[model samples]
Target: MSGRDYDHRRQMGGELIIPALAVCFTLYYFTTIWNSPWTAQVSAFSIGGILLLLCAAFFIKTALLLRSSEASLGLGGLVGIEDVRNGRLALVLATIGYVWLIEDLGFTLTTFLFIAISITALGHGKNVGRATATAAVMSLAGWAVFIWAFDTRFPRGWFETTMQGLMANG
Candidate 1:
């Protein structure tokens, strides 16, 4: 194959992939808003506007990439596609299990397990000790940010009462 043929193939692949992704996003955006129970006119308009903006942005990006000459459609540039595929599967399974375990184990336990498993699965640690420490710190940081800074309430699971007591004391 000639150089021009290879470039044409690459460009065509890029164009195809991006438009497909944009179409999927558009479909999801419509489905979500259509199914949502936003009965109030103002609420429906707000949600619809946001969804439209998201879809517009996705299509705009795809269009820009398709117009660009420098873009390549091949997956070769992205790192750890195989690892990511495996990691994603593991993440999904772990998320489901975590939801089930939350009632029995509590939020802290479930979150910690999920974070550690996810980080490790994403090819985080060559050293066991380092990985454990990193996971611990990340879990703690996430907890602090969500609970303290954002004032967001997560499912406390079995620890609900205890967390409430702590919050009251604080």
Candidate 2:
């Protein structure tokens, strides 16, 4: 790569969207934590500051590359998959399905389905048993940690209610 011609523009400029969104989210997080407790402020700043630094570095690197005509802000790399069936579109649709189904299905069930579907989609429909097992494990862990331990008010569907009753009884 060092000896190769450097004039070729990179097609992955669309990848920068995530870092840009991170910057915005960190700014919003900063605003929210300003009026909170000192501990919250410290934690928020600790993480958000690191995120900002990383985003700044990425922005500078991208700027240098763009200035040198080595990268273009084109969506082709992200959105131009020739085979739409097996590419990013499937992942996007899976995410949409997850979001659409989460409320009724609850976190554990929705997450299970999301992870299973996403793994199958990404793996091109292979690994059915492993994907199902992986999804079940991940969703149960998420439920145990986030829902049970932390007791977050994530929309309570049948699983959450049943678990709540079981824990209360036992």
Candidate 3:
């Protein structure tokens, strides 16, 4: 099959949105940090430049494929055909919920719950034991590092408040 004779409807055209957004963001970031200190802006500028170049290359390649009638705007097929799409959506919603509840649940509990839920959801209920153990270890390790090693003051919630009250009374 020649490049110009292929059906345009089955190509991965929908994947261009991310690169487009990255290009826009890189441009905006450069404009905002153009006058900042070189040391402060150096890393961002370098990364942005690289991102811009890669996005340009991808966009150009996609455009060429489209122009040659070798690609179709089959965005629906790309995301709709995936079996793990629902899992991905669930994980995203869970993440948003995790962030929203962090203040009320506090870091340790919220993080632990989030990690456990994420692992289970992404695993599709398979290997439940492994997911649970990994989530527990990861959550506890994160908490230890941030609270004990780094002394980061996470927000107080029910657990923290109850512990503090108990310590004060005892």
Candidates sorted by lDDT, descending order?
A: 2, 3, 1
Q: Decide which is better by TM-score, 1 or 2.
A: 2
Per-residue lDDT of candidate 3, residues 1-170 (tens digit): 66545653447567888998898888898889888889879899889888988988988888887787667666745566363655787687889999899999887778778888888888787787887788778766866677646758976577556655776798
lDDT of 3: 0.76
Backbone clashes counted, model 3: 2
Model 3, position 51, has a per-residue lDDT of 93
List clashing residue pairs in candidate 1: none
**lDDT of candidate 2 at residue 69, scale 0 to 100:** 73
After superposition, the stretches of candidate 1 with alpha carbons farther than 4 Å from their true spots are 2-8, 11-15, 21-81, 84-107, 144-151, 160-170
Local accuracy of candidate 2 as per-residue lDDT tens digits, 41-130 = 887898889999999999899888778878767664466655476646888888999889889989999999899988987888899899
Per-model TM-score, in order, reads 0.43, 0.54, 0.57
Residue 147 of model 3: what lDDT? 62
Q: What does candidate 1's lDDT look like per residue over 37-125, in tens digits?
A: 65634565666567667667756765676566444555442335665565776777878998898877666667878777766776544
Whole-model lDDT, candidate 1? 0.64
Winning model by TM-score: 3
The CA lDDT of each predicted structure is: 0.64, 0.84, 0.76
